[model samples]
Target: MIKFELKDLEVFYGDFQALKGIDMKIPANEITAFIGPSGCGKTTFLKCLNRMNDLVEGCRVYGQVTLDGEDIYNDYDVNLLRKRVGMVFQKPLPFKMSIYDNIAFGPRTHGIRSKSALDEIVEQSLTQATLWDEVKDRLNMDALSFSGGQQQRICIARALAVRPEVLLMDEPTSALDPISTGKIEEVVMELKKKYSIVIVTHNMQQAVRISDKTAFFLLGEVIEFGDTEKLFSVPKDKRTEEYITGRFG
Candidate 1:
């Protein structure tokens, strides 16, 4: 199933094109990784998926991007589109509230008012994010008190509570320790069973391990996209091979 269809996607920041006529289809219920060196537009392209680029002044786009066959740009309610496409950034940005409240914020904002219902969502979201067991006893404590990795997981839970159909992660584990990275990778593996996931990563091994498919980007162009095993082991593009083999990036 195609969760997102990006066709001839051209992104520009004040006349400087970042993504040049890119075309891709993100599969439903799978993890797709976009990997490339800095300035290759990997992150820029990821931001386009959720229209995060719109937040930046002078950002412009050409071509069509659809979620579940509906044009997101054509929709007047960007806020509604965002609810279906949740994003997690590199830094773990938890609100200055308790862990429980952090997870409850979205559901509450969307009209989930009952305390007991909020409690169930908080617990379920935390469990899905693999952070409940660690902080279940400290729900009322400050979320900032958690470690960097824990904070990121809390953010993930916060995103999950809204029940997004697609999750966009931009180097989600970049700031974490190895153990924390592994834990988040495990969570990513589990999440693919439910939500379609698109990740932008600088960590080659993490991309290889966690993603079902891998797309190589360079200078805002998709060099190659294929199954993870094929893309890493036997890339069709010489550029992709060089980038993977460390010959060039």
Candidate 2:
């Protein structure tokens, strides 16, 4: 099933065009990776899925982006859209609060007030992110006290608390060490059972390892998009082949 469809999408920051007429369908219940070099608009395109680009000053978007058959830009409430599409950034960004509070924050914002309800959400979210067993006894501890990888998993649990249908990750493993990155990659592959995911990554190996679908972008355009193995093994576009072979980025 197609969870999101972008039709002739274009984005601009002042006079610079960031995304140029992009059109693609993001599948449901799978991980779709956006891969490209720095400044290639892969990150810019990821931001468009949840309208995160709106935070940028002087930024403008043109074209239609639909979520679950509804026009996200036209019919959906920005706040509601965000609730359905949660994001995790490159670095761990937990709130300066207890681990329990960090996971409960999203549910609280969505009007879940009961203490028992919040507790259940926190536990469930953390378990889903595969961090509950490790941090189960430390619910009251400060979130920042954990290592970088643990903190990133905390952020994932926080996003899961909102009951989001889609997860937008921007280089989620970029800041972690090899062990932590492996943990995060495992978690991401496990997450697609219930939620659709879109990830922006410079790590081509990571993309191939976890993503079912791959989209390669260059200079604000998608050069190739298809199944991960096919795209990497037998790219039709010269640019994609070159990029995959490490000849040029």
Question: What TM-score, over all chains together, does every model reach?
Answer: 0.98, 0.99
- Candidate 2's residue-wise lDDT over 1-249, tens digit each? 999999999999999999999999999999999998899998888888889999999999999999999998886799899999999999899999999999998999999999999989999999988999999999999999999999999999999999999999999999999999999999999999999999999899999999999999999999899999899999999999999899987
Please estimate how well model 2 matches the true structure, expressed as its whole-model Cα lDDT: 0.94
Per residue, candidate 1 scores C-alpha lDDT tens digits across 63-153 of 9999999998886478788889999999999999999999999998789999999999999999999998999999999999999999999
- Model 1: lowest-lDDT 10 consecutive positions: 73-82
Q: Output the lDDT of residue 72, model 2.
A: 89
Name the regions of candidate 1 deviating beyond 4 angstroms: none
Candidate 2 — which residues are off by over 4 angstroms? none
